[model samples]
Target: MTATTTTAPTAASDSGLTYVDPRAPRFGQAITATVLTAGVVLAEPLFIYAIAAILGMALLSGWRLDLYGFSWRTVMIPLVGPPERREPAAPHRFAKLMGAGFTVLASALLLAGVPLAAYLLAGMVAVLAGVAATTGLCIGCRMYQQVSFFRRLGVV
Candidate 1:
């Protein structure tokens, strides 16, 4: 078994697409954090913004902007320079699904007038994404790893 977590992407899906700058997803997570935090702090229409942000994330996760020739993450995020490492897109896609789940739940709560639950869920996403963005520790990626481990062990 390989001890290293980061590996170059292969054709894991049917799309024949692979390889992504590890930082792109982190940068995306950072944006996810910001939008979600705004929704929690501002409330009302801003929560709609949070929903839109989540939808955008889902779109990008499906399309994988980095799989294309250009990554806004590379161009926008300073100090990142060129791509230094590539990782399989599968985990990131899974992470985005996790993010979408959280944000969707949060949005439903907010729409239902359950502000507390909404904020809590959104806050959780914000914290997770913040940790990934700042420390390069992706909570969703960790979750994926754990799930894979359990699957390998035949426990799940």
Candidate 2:
């Protein structure tokens, strides 16, 4: 696909209108996968700190984009060239919410001393991230769409 650079941190969509970097969430997902992997393997119960950071970044990107631009995606844009490929931000925001909710619950479980449940929850997040990072299948986005479909069908 052809690409073009813009002065803005993100780029326009298929019609060249406002949108977000398709790769930003992928990069974030990879980082997320690594973080969750660490939490699972080390048994340090560090989910609160790490997941809180991810949730904060996700919130920033979803609600406070001026701050979101400070994230790694923006930092790497110069080396990677402006992100000309774009997608709707709504689904990504939904995905982030899902991830945040999962991590928060995982953190709470870790605190409650339910180690098995905590690891399983965190493992789900890691698998979701791994799917996005490796296969580009965003389970969260799929779930968002599914929910939207059900809502439209008056079955939600």
Candidate 3:
């Protein structure tokens, strides 16, 4: 005999999408900005590699195991209450991918004996992440949306 399973449909389940607290990404960005800034200032490749690993974990497992997101949910939510709005998780994931790419490149440059270029690249990421944290203008997320738009239009 064969058996089939049926599941009830809810908003998220039916849409096949998960929502995230909008503040979570900002929180993560703040940490990223600070870490990258310190790494550049101290000329420490170790710090850069640390952030790269965090970003890698975020990409590999998403919010389920993402340290920053877990911290924001468990710690920040208690102090700040729940977020005013929720956002789809896909864009934020894409943003993290961008961050990971940059950090990995920065690490490579540093390891290749190009300290000046490495620090400058890491500094640029810090500035962008800082802007996103403070201003809610996520360049990486915006880029993700543009790419999604192009994909939908069959232009990608």
Candidate 4:
């Protein structure tokens, strides 16, 4: 008789765990980003505390914890995992890019003591992000596509 060997598969080796649909709304990421932005705007330290609290809870629980596909393992446990994979949501990409730009510009203005410009830009970004979060319609995405189209036709 030939010797036989059996192996058991664990969640660690599961393929299903590695797949995430890109078209799916990243509700957790959106929510977390929104909250963080709001906190930054308000100059609140509680936001950081909240993140720490959530992470602490996850660590104590030993259960899988994810925020917008970002795992607690990545955030705290120092465990390496597959990179986050999600469908490319054009609107989100546009909003994120523009929002980041606006944030940087606003910060520069603030550092330069240009209160009006800084506040105005920050307000605009907050409003746009808020509207996109609430309505699922991203003005930045439309603006980016419009610019892209115009540029392609040499319309500036």
For all the candidates, what are their Cα RMSDs to the real structure? 6.4, 4.3, 6.4, 12.1
The window of 10 residues in a row where model 2 has the poorest summed lDDT is 1-10
Q: How do the candidates rank by lDDT, highest first? A: 3, 2, 1, 4
Report the C-alpha displacement of residue 126, candidate 4, in angstroms. Answer: 0.7
Q: List the residue pairs that clash in candidate 2.
A: none
Per-residue lDDT for 1-156 in model 3, tens only?
A: 011113211112226666666777889999999999999998889999999888887777644467787677567767887656567767877888899889988999888999898898889889999999999999999999999999999999
lDDT of each: 0.65, 0.72, 0.79, 0.47
Once fitted onto the true fold, the runs of candidate 2 whose alpha carbons sit more than 4 angstroms away are 1-6, 11-18, 60-62, 65-69
Q: In model 3, which runs have C-alpha deviations exceeding 4 angstroms?
A: 1-14
* Cα lDDT over the full model 4: 0.47
TM-score of each: 0.72, 0.81, 0.87, 0.48
lDDT of 2 by residue, 73-129 (tens): 447676777666678766776787888888888888888889899888888988898
Top candidate on TM-score is 3
Pairs in clash, predicted candidate 4: 22-87
lDDT of 1 by residue, 72-146 (tens): 432443444545556776677677778778777777777798889878888888888888889988878888989
- Model 4 TM-score, all chains together: 0.48
Model 4 segments more than 4 A misplaced: 1-88, 151-156
